[model samples]
Target: MTLCLLTITTPSAVEDVIVDWFLEQEDIGDFNSMPAFGHGSHEGKMSVAERVTGRSRKTMFQLHLSLPTVERILAKLKKDFAGTEIHYMMSPLMRAGDLTAYEA
Candidate 1:
């Protein structure tokens, strides 16, 4: 098995819901972790653009998870949040200095 990093981004208001859904998935196994930081832009009333704008935008939240069960978790996410945006990156770890030009 390989270590995988799962990063999820969703509307801020529904951030808790997304996190909870992942937690409940049985495929997640015993390896899971929270996001290192939460960030995004939200609609503000104080901004001059807001006065001219007629719509409120959704905020974004990012979460990180370490797990080997990638397929199952991804399936669950797709089923639960069909319309939400999701992005993921999978990489394998190599021996130290394996990819660099350095003396052992």
Candidate 2:
């Protein structure tokens, strides 16, 4: 099966809600997330402290999924997270697998 990588970055303040929303998606099997620092020139999106530091705290989630799945997920996110400062990007995944599953 073919797959794409969907990366979503959201404000740290809404991390919990974002995570919960992901967990509620029955089509999603698993995903990876971590604390991230976003450095951008969008002054309107940054807080005073972040502006001074030139970096904003964010939560990033990545999922390896089929193209159709990615589209569906993105549509849902748009509907549910409207008005929230959520950023996303998609990349074509050449391959994905666990090294441990390989034989020596």
Candidate 3:
């Protein structure tokens, strides 16, 4: 088994919808840890600065998945979210050490 970091980025406005879909996925069982963070403009923030920003607001989610191969995970994700614009990054972990040590 390998430890991989899956970072998902979605539009701020559609964060809830995307999160709901992810939680309902059969393949994605209990995540080692799942946290949601909010990023957007402040009340007094300037619109020009926001306009220059590539993404106005984005929600990043991390998941730990054990798969036979990375290709399999990618295939499954593509099949599941056909039209949804989801971006992900996968990095192979060299050493996870022990889960018990990190468990809460």
Residue lDDT tens for model 2, 1-104: 67999999999999999889999998887899999998979624787899999999999999999999999999999999998889999999988769988655
TM-score for all predictions? Answer: 0.49, 0.90, 0.58
Ten contiguous residues with the weakest lDDT in model 3: 37-46
Top-TM-score structure, candidate number = 2
lDDT per residue, candidate 1, 1-104, as tens digits?
A: 45555555444456577667766876654433344322234323324554455443333333233454665677777887786655455544433223467765
Model 3 lDDT, residue 42, Cα: 34
Report the candidate with higher lDDT, 2 versus 3.
2
Clashes of each: 0, 0, 0
lDDT of 3 by residue, 1-104 (tens): 77676666655556676667667777665443234432344322325655566224556676666645445667876887777656678877655545778755
- List residue ranges in candidate 3 displaced over 4 A: 31-49, 52-55, 80-83, 94-104
